[model samples]
Target: MKKLFAMLLTVSLLMVSAGAASTQSSNWAQEAVWTAQEAGLVPETLNTSYDTAITRAEFCSLAASLYRIWEANGQLKDITPSSVSFTDCTDEDVLLCASIGVVNGVGDGRFAPDSPIQRQEAASMLHRLAALRTDYAGSTKNKMPHVFFDGENIRSWARSDVYWAYNSGVMTGTGDNAFDPTGQYTREQSIVTILRLYDASYAALPVPNTEAPYHAVLDYSGAGVSRMHLEDKDGNHLLTDFEDTDGYFYDITVFGDWVGLMWNDNANVALYQPATGKRIDGYIFDGIDEKNGVAWAWAYDDENALVVYADGTTGKKFIPKTVWSEGRAIVWANANTLAAIDKNGNTLWQYKTSFNQDTLVYGLGDRVVIEQDNTNTLLANGKLGTAQTYTIIPNKWSANYIGGDNGYYTLYDQNGKALTGSYANALDEVGQDIYCRWVSDTQYEYFHCAAGGNPTTLFTVTVTNGRPGVLPTDGAGVYALQTSQNTIACFDRFGTIIGTIQTPFTLDSLADITFENGCIRVTRMDIGADTSTQTMLYLPTGEPIA
Candidate 1:
């Protein structure tokens, strides 16, 4: 099979080069260069500069040509991108590539058309092309992508696309066990990578639907009397049954299935599964936050004391420590007994240890992870594996990153299968399918990746002195991360940095950053005063809420 695949690839590259090129490329890329030229992927302007370094604009022109060829050959779905105009560049091909999402401009509305392109930047563009490929694993199962020797050099924001390029075989390294992520790339090298991306797009899946269901919140802003309304983006009523969602409610956040409804401030709260129009169950707390169909909150009275916890699924006193997508939740059956029980309060598995307060339990998709006695154990299928003292960060909606004793980690899907062959330095943080790894002493890599039975699309960035994380949240539209001591970068689901906010406080004082009801909620701590305050910035526009 490998031999056949290699032969087919060779034949594809060797097609239609009868007239040959007037200029030449490196000895290694001679054949690929001519093939790209004959296939109309190489323009006449670049025909003589095969050995020279490729500029950003020049590469986009090449990509645009390839895109046009694919569209003409009926290989791609016609995409009508929005009008893309750049201040520093008016190159038609570059603008065309940007319109179709093949590339992006530098900040401050400039295209930098004449600037040279880096190898990783080139891979990033190729990765974008991979997304449009018919066989791109957007909504399907994707086995792990490749791991490189210097993955840390790849920025967290570009990691997803870079890995996709590597995993899909659209890009290759400069030999000697390195991707040379920041190294310069010549025109011939760019052409070959683009050709690989072209070959893989033959089975391109339809562009992924970005507007999948996410939890939405409604805050009355204290106007109506304990009342709320639910509507879609177009202001169409989604839950008309709630003529008046009455209660002394502080706020309400509902998932699309409406199985998870978080409301607050009342003595008790009743959760209604709006889809079925049936009341699932209810509990009393200061507030309720749900994930993977399980709602949790702090005890109402004695806020600092841990007591009176109940099952998230049922109102029984199982005291759900953590819940996974699985039908079961790991609960504290009693003071000294930890157990996994179903919705009916039946124990499927139990761990008897004096770890009521010290232990931490987190969900990684349908799997459960237990941290007790300085060891971490993987729990699944009603069984617990032998505990090991390796660092582990559990992602409730995707794969888990388990670091070995060597301090290098491998990402594991729910099946406990390795997601990357090469290991990376793991950061003990979690988010909504978002993971960060230590890239260097001062730099951290952040990427949104979740793999269970399948994988979510990946987005990444590399930054220094930042990238600490958040416990998962249902805040869907935009995510904010403090990228540096005084800068918080905001990103969409695709992991694009839509905008950034310059913060006033130092990194040490920034306690937490979260998204609350479509705003960036930044929490800051005053150490001497022992007080914490939260500030909100509106989303998309990042305007101060006040």
Candidate 2:
């Protein structure tokens, strides 16, 4: 990469110096000088000094050039230059920079353009250049903890921009985590900083649609500050800097083109269009299910009326504690009785349970699995049925199988008849036809049990990670498993390894993973520090999506 930069620099110098006379000898800033000249950022007619301190006018000229490049490349748009009336500097570059809010003059209509530029001031200008791009508009300028030993010396207004430059790898401290904010910046240092800023912005270009099948929303919070970002599958950030003011305890659910943000603390939910970063509407919701495209919550000032939002329509009925199914039904438990309601607020059926104990209801296709205190009961379409008592209520998947924590698994038919063979532990169901069962510490068995037919072992996998979980499918039957080694192994129902991806970080460093719309959103963190650093990645390719 350095060699490429050198070659580009040489070409740029040759093009810009075509009809101009060279004034300075080759120096340490030869490459940077060439780059500035080639991009039309610095005037070739001036006698450039590579070791002298950079002036405000020179820095503004460089900033204006970078901004123009971004605008020409389609990364920025609709930037109207400001008409600033500065007393000292009448240079077009300085006026352009000031107009775009990248630079500000001293008070009383005077811009000390000939004064030496400070490090913190330069950082602020570079940050403004970055903000011109739409993808970074949501980023917040939170105070960074322990980033620099001399952070207190930085000007109050420039602290956030300086921290942003430091964290984004565009700038570095002098030594021992000390940022000399008040020091005069040299011409060489100015060029290097500009190059770094240019590289960071260039890498943020949007990914083409054909290569990225999905986008991700990453939530990062630390040191009492939180933010959210949206990025594409190939790791280019689409939106950034969204502040999570309330907290980080929220759920991100995607339906069609919209992403729903459900905060746990409050009943209000926010629906956002990720493509545009616009909040469609905020609604009070207790729970939401994408399969039925419905949000359930108690109406304002009327806790008895259950407000439901589905298909862009709102309906209300007096129902409490509703459990939504994947199909077009909502089931609720009320006074020892379970009732099934359709989408139009019509009650389809109701069944009274034998035991009046407090029960938890879970929908399994057409069957309802109820955990009434210690007894687990399966009711078919709201019909009263027998209950089985277990130490722990078993987890049900695909409606045909229920796995318990007591080292016993059961597979039942549509009529509730138990099939033969005592499977030990069931991990999860793959698609609609296959169930993954744990055979030993490292081995898992995939059974082809369509409609609870005679179980047939389709394939067995010896995973490196003892614990494996199912990944979201890519519309096809192909699924993936994330192992303890932070590796994702993709396979079909037949257990064929179609592809494998090794994550950039370790499994223990992973904070969370959200699988949505055939894409996996992963959050990795460096937890043991004064300030935690959280990074987000888009997998199977393990690229930085945000």
Candidate 3:
């Protein structure tokens, strides 16, 4: 039961704002730092305060706040804070002792609150709070190569307590991997530690909808479809109806500040200032000569590119054969070139070419003047780029192999260069070893390879009486051999049977499995042990990690 520092909640994204009593403090304001502060945990002050000025009463009150916040937020479930006040010295001592699970009451007993909590007294409480079980917990002796610095502080009786907390990430070492169990807990230190344990107790708890600090104002109706609205962080309605149109609409797309609304048939499409609500048609469009609301017809002659609406009039005209034949008429611009007409055969804008035009166009509205050594794209009228451009770069693997969330896993050769020809879609890294399963229209097989790339052998998995022409692994090469009885077997990179092991646990619907903190974490499970009982299987031997 070594102190587990893994429970240590790294201070992430927490802004150290002004404490509860700052310039913004008001008579009716609920304490800003109420949760941590009420837990008898003092808010970290920017300015120095009197060393011993804070009284025992204040400490208890703060501790109470921390306890309440944790409980209300589902931080601690099994244990709850008592409602009894501890003004008397005896009562105070008892409250502290019981809060940390130091002692339990005999038949008809009274706790001595006035007495100073001793080393043994505190140790007992810390031990229980650490939640150590002799039989169920992991053993550290020789399992990990390490030594404790303050090993002497742990009494023989409370050694298990100290060890459990250390191993469970609850208690961390001062330095040199040691738990100073005998050290007196400070008011601040104690409150912080207890709050941490509270956090770990219900780390996976979901927040209630009513208690959620923020929410999204979803446009379930027509407005979210036709018009765009911007809201504040607290979902305050800020900007509404950016387009502000009342005619037949075809499609609307937002590319940065530029919002495009295409009209269907023959409808007047108006662009309004999101902030001012003024008509901004002239600024958005270059010229307006056709009818206010007219439909467009396809160009009868190839020389005249029809750049008009679906009804018939020329809404926006451009040169013929400039854009792609199959795609829409939407135009895209890059650094050096002026404009790019979409497959729709309409030129959106024209840009003056610069000498150092970069071909790497990223998003829809993103535009810069510098030329890249890569792709061809352009920019129009000093607008920002959107992250919608599709550019495919050659990787350690081929473009055909990337589809998952990790984007694409390109296995590098020993020289750390991308191997030109080796690529497959169904490949994954389990531990340091990589496995590839070949999937085709017919079946899936284990693709074995000595190096990271280029499979040498394929072992087809034949499921007796199984469906035919259904490659479960999608033609990638190797299939993780699972028995009909749900047992796990490991095959070498060469598709040779290494060994077999019982499946530690069955994940009902694992959307993803990834490695983090030296362990494999499966996402999308509703119940069961998130960490324990799900041990990593030994691939080389096909044995469970015991």
Candidate 4:
């Protein structure tokens, strides 16, 4: 009887121990560990300790296995492993990772194989791995914007990699704006990041429909309240349910990969990367404008405009009224003074005008066109020449010529030298050496003129209003026009009527029309005891976007 009782007690203890071990392996990382083990990337005998910090050598081994798998899938055939030597990490897998240029030593011929891998170091390694693929090469140079509060803590060498990793969803922070770059990278985090990298490399990237580069903010009524919406240039809805909870008026603008939400209430602004929906801190601008990838913004509570680069570095210059175009800002200092400033806030050139308040400066690819009252002056390389008085073609600032009234126009080169040409009133400059000419009051023709060649008409269109409401930057020749009936008419550069779309509400009910990157944005006002505004977006093709 005594022996039976002792055996039963021992069996019960064994059962309890087994239960505890099973529970430990059944957590969130259990499937990942199992998958890695099955693929032979991780040892089957390894005990699952998800919370434990990963060592350098251990991570290298895992990375090597992943690279080998990728190579087996025919993605890394050009990548040949080179010979490398490290004092500590002499293991075959660790050496393989180094030879493949995915891992490096900590100097002094040592790999620090047993040392815990820091978060930033892991990010760097992952970035290197991603660079091996052509699809990800463009992202490798992307600088880390001010997305985190502790972004300054990140080492310079690791900034790009860390930024790419975080924004691409390969890694996340430990809550708040802190990235914890110096903290230990745990086994669970490493596995998760590796999986995410794999998905990013193999998944189909999202592509916007339109080739134009612009984003728009629209407002509408839904569920008995006002809501704001965001749309890309392709008319795709990005944010459809954004509410103005504070009841503040706002404006939206895009600067390269960053989007700015400027509000009139206290001059508050919010910046975000539309691609990743990640909020970028440390930038305050009342208004933003961009040319190429360089941007200039009106700083809050200051008279100066801040020039910002893609890397989040800024330079300030005093400019009251500024408009950015073709990598330069044309600033109107005072009534008679206009200066062209580069991205570094250096004045490239200055011009004296004869008008104030009625003066408009437009930057066009190394040329500045100053229009005041009824006169237009073209300034290039410190030389000022008068332009024809006709409405400077509605779009195409870089065109060497200006169209005049009564089927007349004048052509010139960038240096303001007159180019001899017999041309009609150009409605718009569609592309390089291409123009949309007015054939009649209701007709237009597309003409292409090659250098040293006669102009050729490509197509013709018969429409009521060939005049574009918004400029075509994509060179596709498509135009959006507002018709007399408050409807939007879509016409090709050659005057072909593609389609017509009605407004969400009515033009009479709206206050103004704004042309944003081929889309029409309008605001409707409800003037009562308490006034309110609603904005809407319409594609150039006349289709309403959300």
Candidate 5:
């Protein structure tokens, strides 16, 4: 086996050297092309014609080969496509690229393999590759204040990708402050661009330990503030300085193998596959939500409904706002309609609801809960479940509990055990065992229970504001409550006050508080002046982020 490995390496090296030999390159591209050959990025047959326009097939070959090598380097999964066939092209390289998701067909399962590739098209392909190689997921267009003078020439679909490719320093524009987005991209240009992307991340980022879980943090390093300092589940360091930044503002979350980063200012969202070290950016959404291990980023759709997307990390596209993984065949719905699509986004089912404002649509795993006019209908995603009139917050089928109505609610565990026997005005889960329930309009009670143990009241507090809500914490089992109009109190499972977070302005009628683990955001709206004030802070401690 060792001898065979050596022989393969020697053959690969010889082919790389032969490709590097007599490679006639333009003066500007000579070194980059040679470097690409040395790194074995270009094909062995790509020994000449450096200035010739790269065909769709040739670029796909290059991208596909490069990505295979890139993914095999300490990659944690085997997501590479093996057998892909296009009607118009049988080129193995094109199939390989298609398999890896770098390129696609034109129409009717036909790949226009011989077509001359456009610069922006190359940007789109390489942008997809960058998500796999450079961890350069997310949008910089919103973060950067300027646009290319020829931005109007760029296609709307390629806009975010072009911005990402340009700003990440992987690809550059044509001169004269123009991108020349439609310009032809040459073989040499593709080689150089791939190498630049390769240099950005190849071997630089060690694959994260997949056996454990990780989360993101912002802390001061020796040079400056390290924005994405990821830590493991045990609070141990995992990776630091995850993405290159000019010290901008953003927050990141890890959902299983995926890490989602959202810019607080622009509402721009990016996702990272920590296992593969690839990123998906350019999603401008209000927020990301996860339930029962099914996570999705959401934004407003047309007619002011919710549009949910499967993170490109999953290689899935626009899915309906279904909550569970098995709900893939289910359609998305507003309060009025339910339209179902297959995994391929085909409309296989449709139902229009005549619901009013009081309707509640809840998802539990693959099953669905629909409550309208005090009548609840529970649907099994091919499974069996019971429903009631109460609003159920879906957890595992075991921990699912109904919501409060008329200022009182009940709680139940997954095993059908009643968690709260007493009447509770409101409730929120603070930890796996700890819960904070409102016993009255003004009094808030925090309690805990073992898996099979009884509920133990930890502490009771009468508040001045009594807003009936708990501030969200980084999933580390800490609960934050607005103790007063102007202050927030954070607690652990034991009802211990972690700290009191203060707001920048008065908590007016339209005040809103949102946060990640390391950051707390408070916004107060003044309709009288048509203005709003927002403040950012370190969580639990309430120290200003700046």
Candidate 6:
């Protein structure tokens, strides 16, 4: 066996010697040339004159150009040159490897680029990308409490974050007692780790489709505050300074013994009575009701009816009670009244009311929902209509609307049509006819709109896995929204930062962020992060801390 191996080695060397031919350093060279004919690393004139295959020294000089690009931007922070110098390799080779974190040392401490990356080391790096910090300052436990698929083998030091990563789906176990924590994690494993850290669900809010960035102090008050009967607009009440509790406001409403709070976005808050539950912000309004530990209030309708003062109509006509549903506000004034109002407080349509003033009304989109005495019926033009009655007993109509989330303002409609033309998109976020942009991951390579523009440039990206829907930057332009690694970034048109929120979440499930005015709306998971107990947070455009 030994003789056969030696003979095979001898034949290999003989073949190499026989095939040794004059080296051609021209563009026509089959192998990669070190020349710069097509922006090659080496100058074509010099590289073409070589009589042999490019030597290690020549390759070093050829590749040194990349150093200049790095210098122009900033010092390579993560990449460091290998400690040990190789006799065969040039300075450029050592420096290039150092700058890219490929090789770190020499001799006993030398990092051999050709050597396989150890499984343990790979797992450690993977942990970093996943933002899993076992001894992190914010960490509550010294070791992770959860059991891993490969639980027993994880080192005590790495146990905390390792456990977090596995439970969060950032890392899957080997289905055994050892996660191979010391084992090399593959590229796929690393990507999955990054994806799981900040899952896509944090970026995507199902109810409101709001904008959410990682590490940003979101304003869940929009949903949570609304639950407390506090209603406000997208940008209202949210203190973007990371230090303050973003305030939330809700519309108080009542229907006899039943009262509930409604949110600015038209979602129902937990119901309770003002007389029973603890008062927040000095409860002083009518129609307060509490039930099942939830508190709510009955709001009053302050908006005046649209009285067509045109020729001679002068009496104050009761503007049907407007109730918000789905995304539009519906109202029914009299038996024959029907109308749809948009977010801008503009009336989309209005129909006549033929029944008496005492007739009870409900908001039914295409038709009128009328309740006379105890009898409920569908009123066409109001004469007798189809007879029907509602036993469920709907809540009474109140006209109190805070301006947005915090402030309330009364809206009076003009006796004119608001929707001059039909909307092409009934469900579009910005509206189908708005001619806005639909950005997938590809469209944002050159630029991404995190908040108020087309493409912002001046910012930093920490973790960019090239995922489909992760936010590119934190919401601040002044501080480069950087991932802990500074790998990915999102920018706007004027070269300002829009978003740079990072999380242990994936881009695939991230909620779409909605930037209304200057406020950003997004949802986050409450995974030990007390900040995201609610579904939505309203942060100011560049000020997300508060």
Q: Rate the local accuracy (lDDT) of all candidates.
A: 0.57, 0.58, 0.36, 0.59, 0.59, 0.33
Weakest ten-residue segment in model 4 by summed lDDT = 202-211
lDDT (10s digit) by residue, model 2, range 1-546: 556766865665567654452434256557655555555555442335556788998887778777877888898856777678887779998898888998888999999988998899988988888778866652432223223445435655675577677766666777644679899887666766676667665222222224433344557757654444445567666433444533233455544445555553445466555565666445444555444455554443443434355434556565453444332343445666666665556777777766443456655334566676577666665554456664222223344545354777666653445654666765466654556778888788766565546777756766554555654654334455555456665444434444565667775534455554334555566666465655444433233334
For candidate 6, write residues 14-49 as lDDT tens digits.
465434533232233322221122222343323233
Off by over 4 Å in 1: 1-23, 139-145, 200-546
Prediction 2 TM-score vs. true: 0.41
Q: TM-score for every candidate vs. truth?
A: 0.36, 0.41, 0.25, 0.38, 0.35, 0.20
Candidate 5 lDDT over 433-474, as tens digits, reads: 566677667687867664454778866766556544443654
**What 10-residue stretch in candidate 5 is worst by lDDT?**
202-211
Q: Tell me the spans in candidate 2 whose CA falls farther than 4 Å from its real position.
A: 1-216, 219-226, 229-292, 295-311, 317-322, 328-330, 333-337, 342-348, 354-366, 371-374, 391-397, 403-405, 414-416, 425-427, 475-546
How would you encode candidate 3's per-residue C-alpha lDDT over 1-546 as one tens digit per residue? 112221221121123344622322222222212333344444454112312223333334444445455446655536544543333344453465356554544324444332333333343454464342222234442112112433423443444454445444444555423445555444433444454554555221222213222222333337345433334346665433333433224443332222334443324343333333444342122222111122222232322333333122233453322222212322334434456453233455555544422233232211222235533222323332222222322111111221222333344332333332333444443211233443544344544343445654434544343332212110111124544234544343235544454554654334233322112233334455553333353322333334
| Cα lDDT, model 5, residue 539 | 44
Q: CA RMSD for every model?
A: 16.9, 24.0, 20.7, 18.4, 21.5, 26.0
lDDT by residue for model 4 (1-546), tens: 545544663465356665355423336665554444445555432345667788988787678767877877777647778989987667987898888788888899988888998999998998888777646654322432323544434665675577677667677777644688899997767776776666555222222223535456557645544344556677777644334434223556666666666544434566666566666443454434332346766655554566666444556665545445445666666668777777677888877766564556655534666676677666666567655465443224343654455776645554344444545654456554556666777777665554343566655655553463333332223445445445655554334454576766655524456555435576778777998887877654455666
Candidate 4, residue 426: Cα displacement in angstroms equals 5.1
| Model 6 weakest lDDT span, ten residues long | 426-435
lDDT ranking, high to low: 4, 5, 2, 1, 3, 6
For model 3, give the 10-residue run with minimal summed lDDT: 470-479
Alpha carbon lDDT of residue 18, candidate 3? 47
lDDT of 2 at 337: 67
Top-scoring candidate (TM-score): 2
Native-to-model Cα distance after best TM-score fit, residue 185 in candidate 1, in Å: 1.2
